[model samples]
Target: MQNKYVNKVLKFLKWGAFILIILIAYTIISARITGADPSFMGYQFKNVLSGSMEPTFRTGSVIQIKLTEKEGTEYEPGDIITFQRDGILITHRIIEKIIHGDAVTYRTKGDNNDGPDIDAIPAGAVLGQYTGITIPWIGYPLGFASSKLGALILFLIPGVIFLVFGVHYLRGWRLSRG
Candidate 1:
């Protein structure tokens, strides 16, 4: 009876891990193919690559950004937003809002920085607002997993483990039947 319960628990965990791995793989592949960040349920996950936002969120932390439509979304001075600049995503707090008739721009600054950024970001360049949900220190592993070699190792280790476990289970079953 104990053995049966243990097997059931292990099976449950195995499936859960498999699903998580598939999700991660999909996210990486889709981003590479689309040339844009993938969003799940209106939220995009991004990794912090610098200490600019330190004290608020450290480098190597993963943050969730809530995707919003550019037309209707309202931004203020205190809001932290993610924007694309020269093909790179940057997260910073809005220091000021400049309005020119119907046009709008934002002056942004990192929380730990000494001065605001040199260029004002057009409203259309804004990607999403930071959701304040961070997973500390997970970005390191995530960054690795996105690489070709790292992804191969990630999937290979699990495949080998599952293969070994399957063989062991089959052997035990055959012995019991005999």
Candidate 2:
């Protein structure tokens, strides 16, 4: 009974690892081809590149952003959002909202910063809102795996393991047949 339970647990672990590998491989390939992060179920994953949001979420953490249509979404103060400014993506909390005859802008400030950001961004610049889902410290490994060398190592090790298992299985089958 114990042996059977151990085998079942090992099988479960193997499947879990397989799924994780597939997700990582997909992320790497999609990012390289499209120059954009992949989204799943209306959510996108991004790595925190700075400590601006520390205490809420620290650097080296991976965050989930919930994608929404810009036209219908109404953002307010106290909500954390990810937006683009001068070609850079920034995540910050909305401290104030400015509106002028159908034009809307937001004043954002980082949680760890002393002052608000230098400029107010137009509503069109908003990308998504933070979903409060974070995986701590996994960004380092994910960042590495996105690199060329890291991708090779990521796939190569698993390939070799699968190859060895294939050979072993083939040998066992042949011996049983004989």
Candidate 3:
């Protein structure tokens, strides 16, 4: 009976460790492919930051995203969208969309801001149109988590598990050999 219980525990530990490793690996890779920080974003961010989006989106809120398909999607004058400006992320509503047969340009402004963005939105720069807004503070915590920290956790989790498993497996093998 004791041997059976020990066998079950060993099986559980092995599978659990494998699953954890796979999860961590996927998380890091997916984040990398998306050009986003794994900690706060996954393909898309949940919360919107900055007051520039006010009435449309408040600080500590969330927004949806879709990769710009084939250049840029159709932009309506009032559609909310997120784009990176000089490496900084920003979300604003489009006041006008200029299209000239395969060429698309956008003029954007914040619902609460006094003026429009000094620069025009490059058609190709748009991430996606925000279908809706969400209220969540998830972005703040994600911002705190860094890739380095994720790497540390990825290695640490496996190391700890392997150490524990190694000890347990060795003990089981010893008992069986005896």
Candidate 4:
């Protein structure tokens, strides 16, 4: 009975791990394919690559940006927003908002930056506002997973372990049958 209970627990844990791994794999792959930030349920996952937002968010921190309000009402001065500039995503705080005729523009600056950005950021360039959620040091692994070699290692480690265990189990079963 004790052995049976142990087996049941072990089986439960194995399945749990498998499900979790699959979920993580799906998220990573989806993020890579989508080209947008990895997001679920209105929350975006972003990795801070620079210290520009330091004192607020440090480098190598993983931040969760939650969508607040509807599209038109969400942006305001003092809000930290992520935007695309030259094909790269940059996160900064909005220092000013300029309205010219029908267009809305933002002046942004990093907390640690010496001055505000030279160019005005158009409203269309904004991705989403930060929700103040941060998980420190998680960006390092996330950043690593972005690379081809890192992804291979992340995927293969679990696969090789499972393969080895499966082979061992099959061997044992065969010997028992013989």
Candidate whose lDDT is highest: 1
Per-candidate TM-scores read 0.84, 0.85, 0.64, 0.82
What TM-score does candidate 1 reach?
0.84
Query: Which is better, 1 or 4, measured by lDDT?
Result: 1
Per-residue lDDT of model 2, residues 1-178, tens digit only: 9999999999899789878878877876887799877887788988999999888999999999988576413889998999999999999999998988888899999999999999998888888999889999999998997788987997899989878977997999999999
What lDDT would each prediction earn against the true structure? 0.90, 0.88, 0.74, 0.86
Q: Which residue pairs clash in candidate 2?
A: none
Query: Given candidate 1, what's the lDDT at residue 121?
Result: 91
Task: Count steric clashes of candidate 2.
Answer: 0
> Which runs of model 2 end up more than 4 angstroms from their true locations?
1-5
Number of the top TM-score candidate: 2
Candidate order, TM-score descending: 2, 1, 4, 3
- Of 2 and 3, the candidate ahead on lDDT is 2
Off by over 4 Å in 4: 1-7, 67-73, 168-178
For candidate 3, write residues 1-178 as lDDT tens digits: 9999999999899798688777767876887799765442324554666778777667776666655566665677988877878887778889988877878888999988999889888878887767674656666654544447856775787789789978998999999999
Error of 1 at 163 (Å): 3.3
Cα-based RMSD of the predictions, in order?
Answer: 2.4, 2.2, 5.1, 2.8
lDDT of 4 by residue, 149-168 (tens): 98899889999998998899
Clashes of each: 0, 0, 4, 0
lDDT of candidate 4? 0.86
**True-structure lDDT of candidate 2:** 0.88
